[model samples]
Target: MGRMKSSNRKKIIGALGDPRIKPYLEASGGNEKDALALYRWSVELTASIQETLGVTEVLLRNSIDVQLRKWNNEQLGHSASWLLESPASPLRSMTKSKRKEALRRAEKSATCRSASHFRHGQAVTHDDVLAHTMFGMWKDILPNHSPGADPEKTENKNRMTLWEDAVKNAFPCAEDPEGEKTYWRVAHLHELRNRVSHMDSLLNVDVLDVTRDAFALVGSIDPVLANWLTGTSTVSAVYGKRPE
Candidate 1:
């Protein structure tokens, strides 16, 4: 082993902006060799997480979309973007200002549908609606009245209520009897996905746990899909190679 080139060394140090990596390098007394090793491990771990998260994100979005569509068609008789504004949606329970803001964000996302045409060479389908929308927008509609609130009050009142109604209704089924647990899990995974998508450091995160929770959510939605995802995932192999 020869010494690393000056330019390569500088690049390695510059990439170590993640705060979690600093302490390890400091513990190594600023040794360049150790710093490079730690940096490589960080890069490898981030790559592994990004790969696994890509699969999980798609699975989650698809699962939620499928269930939402089923519920909307069954209850509302139609399942288009207009369903967001339907009386049956939890969005109807938000305060006037909050409801406006949520709709505004959702509209902005809808506008971005043209970008999909440029990329995929096809018009955006109904299934692509959630893909266009941001996770924050979805989470915003979760704070409405409880599952069985009075329809009258739901229209104008914005009282503190059990926030799990959105999740329960969105994924209505016998699989998840209490949707609160699934809601929290999916919410946390959404936050993690945001961080990874923005190229932020995840050195402190338990990537394995996040992956497992994502798979569990998938299973809750569709056991066959979950098993297929598990068979195709490389996350376990990646975790096995973590720095010792």
Candidate 2:
């Protein structure tokens, strides 16, 4: 056995048995040498292309994101990242500016509409968006709710509380522990929006983290988004599926 393994040519010939080579050979009607050569070319192409471009270019290679349950290659997954909501896509635009214009009329007419009707899941007056926004704001405020509440005595309020009308109007009282949790979440999102409005910085890593958690909050979290993000969901995903 040791003598058989000593030849370099024998070792190269041995590679013909690699599991990955069979499919390509079957698909292309070739022998082990042909399949192996093709594999080497694919490897070179992938590495060369990545070096020619940047890492950012490859970020979208993954298509089978389990989370959003859609091909990520088709659309970016919803992670608490800075998404600019398109007013025309039949899905919620991550864009705040766009959502605002769509929700303007809804302050008076509280009706929820389907994503297909709008430019994207955004309409001028969407009750669902409004309600979600309201919830999000209160959640953000939960961190510092109990600063000074005795209005009769006119106690000094926390500096954070006086930041804006949105802080004053949308946040829930520090007292509602159970309900406040939910409200604070909404408020934190509003705060993030505020940060964006102020021309602050955003992080994609942080965005992915936020997306994971927010997905849970919205019941849309997918552990598979990473695979999709990595482009591992192509043909392999079908094989990954269990027998029906």
Candidate 3:
């Protein structure tokens, strides 16, 4: 809680490496103390953003999962989870690999935890794999838009069909007929999540804008949840504490 000593700051800067501290040091106009303070502030800000993103990720995943499950069952009958579908149907080549990887990791985790539902000799459940999936998996699974992309391509057509059949329902409050807006918003948050996960610099990032985007995305699915998330978020408070 006390101001860090100059010697202690020096040690921290050295440990953090010159490259890592360079942007902060520059922003502080060569003042090592101010730079170090900014670095600490950034760490706190990152933590706050991570916390908010955690909630958003879970909400996004669950909302999409519910729709996907319903759509999968409608298409393939009872007890059919889209996540368990083979390469021939939805999920296709693009996502099948990622799904397999996530499921493999989930199974290993369940085995390690000796999960109650994960019988030693039995296969892992959909919930287990879903819980283990990364944020990017959800983002990438959504339809994409490119100016030059051919609408007739198998992948593009499949993405559109999936959106029409299932993904669009994930956002009950949003109006994204073609899924473009949703994809762009999710993509922005996905990049921010990656930066935070990698412990990269946020000194130049418009973190407030990122927060707004996050809330907006959440609001699209459920305004009540968005209100709750925004009301409880610490991003604004952390942002206010930034070193001048």
Q: Which structure among the candidates has the greatest lDDT?
A: 3
Residue-level lDDT for 41 in candidate 2: 49
Candidate 3 residues 76-133, lDDT tens each?
Answer: 6675766655533666565787888878898787677654544665677888788888
Ranking by lDDT: 3, 1, 2
| Candidates' C-alpha lDDT | 0.57, 0.33, 0.85
Best of the candidates, TM-score: 3
lDDT of 2 by residue, 1-244 (tens): 3433335533664664555455555644655445445555444433322232222212211110121123222344443311223322322322245446434545334344545645444433223443323223223222344345352431122223222212222222223323334334334444543443433323111433333233232321123433343352122232223121
Work out the TM-score per prediction. Answer: 0.65, 0.24, 0.90
Better of 1 and 3 by TM-score: 3
lDDT of 1 by residue, 1-244 (tens): 8988878876767776647457556655777667667556656766766776667667665655555556446556765443344534443453234435545665665566664456444443444444545555444443333456553564423222323333454444325544545656667777877877765555567777888877787676667767887887776786676553
- lDDT accuracy of residue 206 in candidate 3: 96
Model 2 off-target regions past 4 Å? 1-177, 203-209, 220-244
**Candidate 3 ranges with C-alpha deviation above 4 Å:** 1-5, 85-88, 114-123, 146-150
Query: Which candidate would rank higher by lDDT, 1 or 2?
Result: 1
